[model samples]
Target: MENTTTLGCLVLLCIFITFPRTKGACRFRRFGIDCRYSCNCPGGCNDVNGVCRGPCYPGWHSGNGTVCQTKNIAYNGSTKQSSNYYTFKYLSNKAVDGNRDQNIYDGSCSHTGLNKTSASWQVNIEPPTQIYQVKMYYRQDLRKRFRRFTLYLNDVDEEWRVCYHHQKDSIQSIVNVNCNITTKTKALFVYNERGTPETSGQSYERHAYMELCEVEVYVCSKGTYGDCRQFCYCKDGPCDFITGQCPGSGLCENGFTGQHCQTDCSSIGKYGVNCSESCSASHCFNRQMCHRVTGRCLDGCQDGWIEPTCVKHTQVVPCHLSVKVNSDATELCIRSL
Candidate 1:
């Protein structure tokens, strides 16, 4: 009987090996659905995990469900350079107003207030951003005046880090600058100090006019603007850098709460980038500001308080019965400790 039982077990093992489960393991689709294997790649990516896949759809991710995320391109139709326009002969903001018109006959040549010996045009990328691609279009008609321009990233120490420099070269052409500038910066500068070959520091030469039809600053890689919020949680697809909007889970980063994750989590007991940190109700001993991100007491709780945003209490007093006399009048009273 024992021999028969062993033989039965062997037969069962053979059967299991002959008909192994093949979900995600089948290699040949020619064998039909019963033999087709699959991976966790997005609906279209057939590459193995961790391989550098082709660029996903614009504003989308490979692992994500292909939902278009917001790109972090520098020009959002709102981000402009400094309010200090290059005051040339009549040039002003129109030159850098993001309008690309080659029609010098219609004032495109002088729209940005031309011919300044010392002038600067800068763009604010909000909290400073690592810019990689910078495209500056010289006023089509006044291209000759855009000679000798330099690009810089403003550092926190108030120093300018020169990224690109253009010599007194051809005018009336689009200058596309691509570089690896991966530093978080507050602003980018277009410092054009060179005037026409004859213009001086004190005087403006009509040939030395400096103007740009359009200044477009963009991030290098595709499918991203500056950076995504915590990788957009990488759920459904990705997040938009400019808008702070995500796809999957429809959730924003910490310290932020809203449909689009645009509103910060600010009230009485909270503060931080994500806004999810909780501050102490009584301020952790009643005399200190909690940490903005961790919500810990900056000055520590008083004597009898817990940590990590807990309440504070002096101490619990015991109750006692006692007799007291007021104004020579003896009376029995209950005193609280």
Candidate 2:
């Protein structure tokens, strides 16, 4: 009787394992098995095949049955901004160092105010995808009495400040800041606080100058998913969502051509068919018809002729030849006259 009971339990276990569960089935509790497919899980986290293990997190999504990935977003801008402070201005001046003309500013300050000189050139960032971080590059000029600076994102009101203090003859300093870029427009504001009255009246004798070079923005889809954004040329192919058309490369497939790969090559002359074969050959020797294939004279002249159509002779013979006669003959010798 005990063996019989054991066999029955085994059969029951097999049936539970092999059979498919109905809707709202809690196999995790029924069979004591970590459920691979369960609609009962929170957020409809399809745990089918045990591979689809995790729920689609807040910033993530799953398309295929088992593959969960982040989405891709694109950002559009003429210039990429950097977080490094030295990339602001003074982008390698030629009058400074012999081998390298660029100079670094070295001064000290407390906290003055923001400088808004570059307000005309508005930066429009349209992300074809989502973005996460933004980096900027900047440097201070020593002659200007380098000091502290502030960065403003999107607008002047949103700002972050950093300080620098250490008097030196001349030096260059760089700073990098990571910030979020959720909007289309971003602004940069630099504050020159070299010698403020509140801190030290010593009066920093230099005019603080800042240089910005480049800015880079990092993007992520659905939290940390998708491809890192890149400036694509879209050459010889369809225009990417960011840039309009492909650049520098040949036209896309089919009949496309030209710089933007927009010209159609369908009408271009091809071999055989109705296309003119010898139409481009220059008409030499006047009206002589040129062989379509060889682009040479068809039935015109063999050689030696020089007329426009090889119809006239270039060489002719005179009617008579010149002969020498004796002038001092004896007595009017006209015997045969």
Compared with the true structure, what per-residue lDDT tens digits does model 1 show for residues 84-124? 33444335444445456756555543333334456566656
CA lDDT, every model vs. true structure: 0.49, 0.33
Runs of candidate 2 with Cα error greater than 4 angstroms are 1-124, 127-132, 140-146, 155-172, 180-185, 191-205, 221-337
Q: Candidate 2: RMSD over Cα atoms?
A: 32.7
Best by TM-score: 1
Q: What is the per-residue lDDT of model 2 for residues 147-233, given as tens digits with 9 covering 90 to 100? A: 344444453334332222234444344443444443333433334434344453444442333343333344432111223122121
User: Looking at model 1, how many pairs of residues clash?
Assistant: 18
